[model samples]
Every structure is written in structure tokens, then in C-alpha cells.
Target: MSGANEEPDIPDLPAADPLPRSRWRMQLVWLVPIVAILIGGWLAVKAVMERGENITISFKTGEGLEAGKTRLKFKDVDIGVVETVMLAPDHKHVLAKAEVARDVAGLLVDNTRFWVVRPRISGGTVSGLGTLLSGSYVDVDVGNAAKARRDFVGLEEPPVFASDVPGREFILKSAGLGSLDVGSPVYFRRLQVGQIASYQLDPDGKGVTLKVFVNAPYDRFVKTDTRFWHASGFNMAFDSNGVRIETQSIVSVIVGGIAFESPPDSVEEADAAANTQFELYPTRTDAMKQHDRIIDKYVVNFADSVRGLVVGAPVDFRGIEIGRVTAIHTRFDAQRHSFSIPVEIEIYPERFTSRYQDGRTGGRISDDPRGIANYLVDNGFRFQLRNGNLLTGQLYLALDYFPDAARAKINWDKSPPELPAVPRTLQSLQDSVTRLLVKLNSIPFEGLGNDARTTLRTANALLSQLDTEVVPRAHDTLTSAQTMLDSANTALQPDSALQQSTADAMQELTRTAASLRTLADYLSRHPEALVRGKSGDKP
Candidate 1:
């Protein structure tokens, strides 16, 4: 009964309420909320798909850091954003949490460098001026490695060169870091081709090792025999060649720089590989010197003073440089009771290759070094100190043949070997002057002067004697001779009696000679008259 009552009531009520057919299309008012929900779903999906990695960067300080504000940029283009900045656990630095775009995943590799961008003046370069207007930002330099890392150490200073600056790296070892720094320029023929990337003391603490990057095209110019030197400031040298000064450029002088050059005369060699190690010479002269392969060290004992000789003084064969003086030492000879100067010379035997070509072929000059040494000594080869520059008083060593020099031999048994040395030309001259002075000192000049005075006195006395004695006698004798001559003149007078008597005697002698001449003629006419003679004459 209850069912019948409830059914009838329900059917009537349903029929009455037969509620108008529900519309198939939603209302315009509802469309607004539906569209908003759809848009919200689309945004959620997009965010999920485009989500980026969260990276942590440790910085020494967060001077200009601001969460949700700073951005990571590359080439002035934003690549990431800083989400948060907090103090590190150690409190020694600040940790920056950043969100980087997924597209730059390849850039987040090992060696990727990051630093803050702000107005900076460093190493003579002004950078990040735009950061002043746009506010500070995080800068990144993607590295060239395969490994990737999310945690990074932020750099305090900006990198010297970005990866976009195509170049090759090289290593240079120097005795000391003169004026070189990270931003110092590298010059190839005075053109800025690169810069010093970094520098550090050697592990041994004996020298400095510098990393340098040579820009692409210029890197090819570096050869296996390339030489590097400090081209900054003044490259001054004072020696036999006199004073010399050299500099790459005014900029280099102000900021310091490195210069590299390959010897023009050197053989064509392959380009140096990346990260090649080279020696950084103090000056270009030392860098350009030909490398000597064969060095023969020998000691030369000098009796003369080496006042002007220096360690780097060149040792020449005749006029050709073959070596240099490496060191000089003084020794006391107990046996001889004298101090001797021993000069240690470094001789590059290879320097004589062009001259003594026979040595190369192993002929009379054998490859055995002692053989050459013996031959040289036997042929009167000796070492002599020479004045290289008169103004600088620089002395060098000269090797030449001296046939008249005292005989000597090389003592090969001694360490470094021993060679004979002659006195320097100046020392020899000084010694000669000293000997002359000694001889002059030995000469009895006072005695000579006294003898000269006595001789003058004797000469005066002799002159006086001659004037008082011989001169008057000679005059008297001359007068007597004049009288005799006068008498002879009187006897010879034409009107004198002796003259008349002489004429009569001459007439009688003439008659006698005429009669004798006639008798001789009669005898010559008649040969029989010789015996019958003058029979008529005899009768």
C-alpha cells in the first residue's frame, strides 16, 4: 500500500518537474572558468617539460648578488638566472643556486668558468661597463671538455680569453718572473698576438712557469726552434759589442710583454705542438744564439791578471766565436808558492764543423777529442786573453797558433782538462813597461850624470891647455914655415945671381946632351962602328 502511494506521488511530481531539457552547450558565463582551467593545465605541462637544471656556484663574495634578479650571460645574452644565494657551510664563500636553460646543456661541461659581471678595471683593461646600468650579472665561458659538472667554483677575476678566441696554448719556463703578469701581451714581431694566460712558481721553487695562448694564425709561426724572451722594458746589454737597448713597443714597455721569434737561418721545422715547453730567455740575444750540441769544457791557467775578463766573454778561434768563459777561479799553488787564475771555458766543438771539416770525416783529426787536442797543442795552439772593447774594458778569449810561444801540452789527466794560456796583450804590454821601468831603475843615472859633468870639466880644461900651449906653438911653427917659404921665393927671383948661374949650367948641360945624342946616332948608323968604334972616333 505504501509503495502504491509513493509511486503515484513520485510520478506526478516528476512529471510536473519534468524539468526543461538540459542544454547541450555550456553557458557563456561557465566558458570563462573552463578556458582558465585549460590554460592553467597547458601552463603546468609547459613548465614540467621545460624545467632546467639547478646549478650551485661558490663565489668568494656576493657583493652584487641578488636572488631572482641576477642572470648568467654569454656574449651579452642571458643563458641562466640566479634563483637563490646563501652562505656556504664553511662560511668562507657564498653559494649561488642558478637555473640555466636546458638548451645550454652542452655548455655546462668540465672547466666551464663562471664569474660575476660588474664594473671592473683590471690588468689595464676596463670591462663590464654595461653591468653598471643593467646591474651585476653572472658571466660564463663554456669549456672545451667532455665531462659535465653541476657544482662549480666561481672565478674571482674574469678569464683572460674566452673559448671563442681561437688559439693554442704554450708553456714557457723562466728563471724568474721579471715584470710579467697575467694580462701581459705576447708579441710576434712586435705585434700583439696573444697574452700571458697564467703564471706560477715551479714545483721546485727554482723558477717560474707561464701559460700563454697564441692566437690561431700566429700560433703557426712558432716553430720547434722558436725562442721566447722578455721584450718589455729595456733589453740592455753592455759587452764587447758596446751598449745595446731594445724594446717591442711603448705598450709593451708600459704593461710588460713577451716576444717570440724563430731563427731565420734555422732549418724549416714543424710547427710546435700545443702546450709545448720552451725556455724564456732574459734577452733576445741569448735566445737567438745557435744551440750548441757538443760542449768541451777545459781549464786554462793564467799567470796574468784577468781584470777585464767576464764570465760570458766570448771565446773565439781566430775571429770566429766558438765558446765562452763559463767561470773563473783563483788557486794557490803550494809548490810554486804563487796564486794562479784558472779560467773555465765552455767550447762548442761543433762550432768548428765548417772549418775543420776533416774532424767530421775522422781523418787526420780523429773523432777522438784528445787527438784533436794533442794535435792542436803540438802545432802551437794556445789561449790568449784579448781586449774586445777598449771603451768598456771587456776582455775575451782568443785561440790561435803561436809558433814562437813556449812549448806546452794539454794535461788531459786533470779534471776538465788543462790547457796552456798566454798573457793578455795589455798585460804583456804592462809587463814590458814594468820591465823597462825596472831596467831604468837599475841604470846608474846619477853616475852617468856625474861622468858627463866630469867629461865636460875635462873638455874645458883640455880647451884651456890647448889655448895656453899647443895653439901658440902651432902659430909659431906656422910663422917659421912662412919665413922658409919667403926665402925660397927670394932665391927663385928672376933678377937674382942664382937664377943667372942656373941658366948658364942649363946651357952647358944642353950642349953636352946634344953631343951625346950625335955619338949615339953615328953608332946606330954603323953596326961595325960599334967594335971599330968608333975607330975614327978612337983615332
Candidate 2:
């Protein structure tokens, strides 16, 4: 075995044909490594090329943002990752660096808006609820601006409407914000058509200015004469029309909203321009009462209490409303040494003239206020304070004819022709009550009580005397009369002498009649002598 092994070693398999150096040198071992390196480099290049642009978004808070964990989303789809979260140079805000996909690079516009999306409840709506489980994310809303941008200032609150949304904006001036919220719906004839975009104090600080957006097509319905009002909560009103309860919807009642309508009779065909300014009324009735005509202001001096009268009280003429009370104040008339209420009122005469006119424009009843006032005075028109709602204690101004009203004249020389005013019925009743109270206070209660007591004692004594003395005398007189009557009855008994005398008189009368008959027969036999004998018998 040793010898065979030695021989095999010696043979060495003919040196295994001396593996060619060229072949060994040309081996693909290095090529394999090179190809792998090349492939790795290509993959790296592709990864770099596919990477997106990095942008920094400054936010007031870092609430839901996390480095490398939170993603930026568009339309609910992830489009980028938050690379880092750090404070800005000023340290006033958090800067979130995000790497957005290259395909969505064009969406980073100047007007692009970003906000953190977390479960939030606002204006009776629950939004971003799905994020509660999936984790909060950064939401990006692309804008329609032409210029592209990288750095963006994030929005603290989500925008009510997207920049690219088709709509028209309008500005409404209101006395107050009421219950309106950013997400409050706007209704057109009870149909939801838009939403309140935003609101803030007016620049002049006189009222609130609301920015509203109406979705496309529906916006075209807006006209110059359109009216808007707050349609939130229950509208409980008691007027001449009686008690009324109105509500837009249960949701609106809770969250609040705005409503608009283009009065068919007032609105023109053309659409209102974008950002048109309009007045926001407090109620639907008020909005409907708005007229596009000149208003005339006047002042009324009343000698009655204006306790129940308030601003915006109805000013009526002959049971029809023609104006509203604007202000009420008390003034001292030094000359007359009396205090009176000076009430300011605004009247829209166009409301009355429009009824007789053919177009939107109408003529005023009278430009010369003094002349009109004189005419009204002659017609027995006078102002009086009356109860509007007895339960609510609300009052209104009433203009009516009072033919027998106290004579009063209008002072045309005054700036606002002072119209005559009759004392309010309530005031008259109060005066009567005061007079009756004075009369009662003046009565001498002590003297009246003494006199009444004395009268009562005298009447009681007189009654006692009549019962005791007069009654006994009357009884004695009646007894005496009864005795006399008994005596007369005894004298008229049936077998008395008067009865026998009456029977004898009857027998004598019968004998006389028989004699007269015998005489009459003799006269019939002898004519003349019988006549004389009959006559003697008759005598």
C-alpha cells in the first residue's frame, strides 16, 4: 500500500495538465463581484431617483406629529413621511420636515394647506375618527395656486373649504355672531347648499363679519336682493299673527346655522358678485320685511311711561306696520318743567308706495314732513302707546284716529314735526287709581264708624218698642171687635120675631092680588061702571 501511494504521488496525475494560467487568470470570480457591485450601484441610483422632495412645515404645535412615524396624507392616502420634528429658529413653532413623493411634488403650492388630523368634535360633527385607530397624521390639501412652494405654515384648525373647491364667497354683516359656527350649514329655501367659512369682528368693531361660501351652481342663485338670517334654535314669537314656533332642524337648533333666500319679487335675474356684502337679520320675519327703499327717521315725544317699549318695537299706522322704534330716551323740558320720553323711529315710506308703484323704485308719500304731519293732524291721527304682548310686557307705537281726543297741534317748526300724542290707556287707568286712592286716604274712618254704630243702636231700639207695645194694642182691639160680632149673630136666630113678620107680609100681599083680579073681571062685563070700580079697587 505504501508503494502504491508513493507511485501515485510520483505520477501526480501527469501534473493535472498544468491548469492554464490564462484560464485561471480569466476566471469569473472577480466578474461576479463586479456585476454584483454594478447591480448594487444601479439599485442605489434608482432609490435616490425615486426619493421625493423634502419640505419643512411650521406648526404652532407638535401635537400629533412624530419623526419618521407620522405620515402626510392627501385624500386619505399617505403621500409622504415626516422625516424629523424640531423647533424652528425662533422657537415659537415646531418645524416638521417631510419627504413627499416625487409624483405629488406639484401639489406643494403656495396656497397649499396642512394640518394635523386627529379625532375632533366641532359644530356637531365628528371628524378624523378613523385616525383614532390608524394613528394621527398630517393632512395636506393642495391649492390651485400656480407657484410651487416647499416651506409651508401649517393651519391650526382644518380649513372649512378647500382652495380648489368651486364656490363663491360672501360677506355678511350682523349685529352678533349668534350660534353660528365654522361648520354651520347655510340653507337656501330649507335646502342645504353651503357653509359658513369663517367669522370675525368687523374691522370697525361695529358688528360681526361672516365669510360664507356657497357651492357652485347654487351660488348662482344668490342675487342682490337676497336676504340672510340666523336660523338656529327655536324661534318663539308672539305678534298680531299670534304665537308661532319655528325651527329649521333639530341639528340646526343645537349647532346653529344660516339661511338665505332670494325673494322672487325683489331679486333681479343677474347673480350677485362674489364677496358681495349683505346684512344678516336676526329673524326670518325681519329679513323678509327688509325693503330696498329710502327710510325716513322721526322723533316722538311721549308723556306716558315707556317701560315696556324697547328698541326695534313696531311702529304701526292704522293697524299696519310702517316703521320701527330705533331709540328711547328721557329729556327734561326746562320751559315746561316736565319730563317726557323722546323716542326715535325710522319709517320706510317706500313700503307703502311700492304697493301702488309698478317697479322696484317708488316715490315717497311726502317729502315735506311738516305738510304730511299737518295733514295727519287734521285727519285725527294721533300716537299712543299700546300693549304688543300682554304676557311679555312688550309695547308698540300705535297711530289711530281719535275724534274726541284732547285738542293738540303739531309744532312744524321743530326739526322733526312733533306729532300729537294722547295719554296711554294704561296711564289713564293709573291716574284713576291714584285719584281713588287719594279719596280713600281722605275719608274719616273714625267718625264714619261712630255714626254707623249710633244708627244701628237707634234702629234696634225702635224695632224692640214696636214689637212689645204696638203688638199688644193691636191684639186688644181685635178681641173687642170679635165680642161685638158674637152679639149680632145671637140677635139674628132662625125662630126670631123678624121671621114671623116676614111670613104675614107675604099672606097679605097674596090677598091683595086676588082682590085686584076680581075687580078686573067685573070691569070686563060692565064697560064704564066696571072701569070706575076697577080703578077704585086698584087705588
RMSD of each: 6.8, 12.5
Best by the TM-score measure = 1
Candidate 2, residue 344: how far the Cα is off, in Å: 1.1
What lDDT is reached at residue 465 by model 1? 100
TM-score of 1: 0.77
Q: Candidate 2: which stretches are off by over 4 Å? A: 1-51, 202-206, 236-245, 354-361, 367-370, 403-417, 426-539
For candidate 1, write residues 232-255 as lDDT tens digits. Answer: 787777889999887899877887
For model 2, residues 431-525, the per-residue Cα lDDT tens digits are 99999999999999999999999999999999899899987998898999898888667656777676667778889999999998887877677
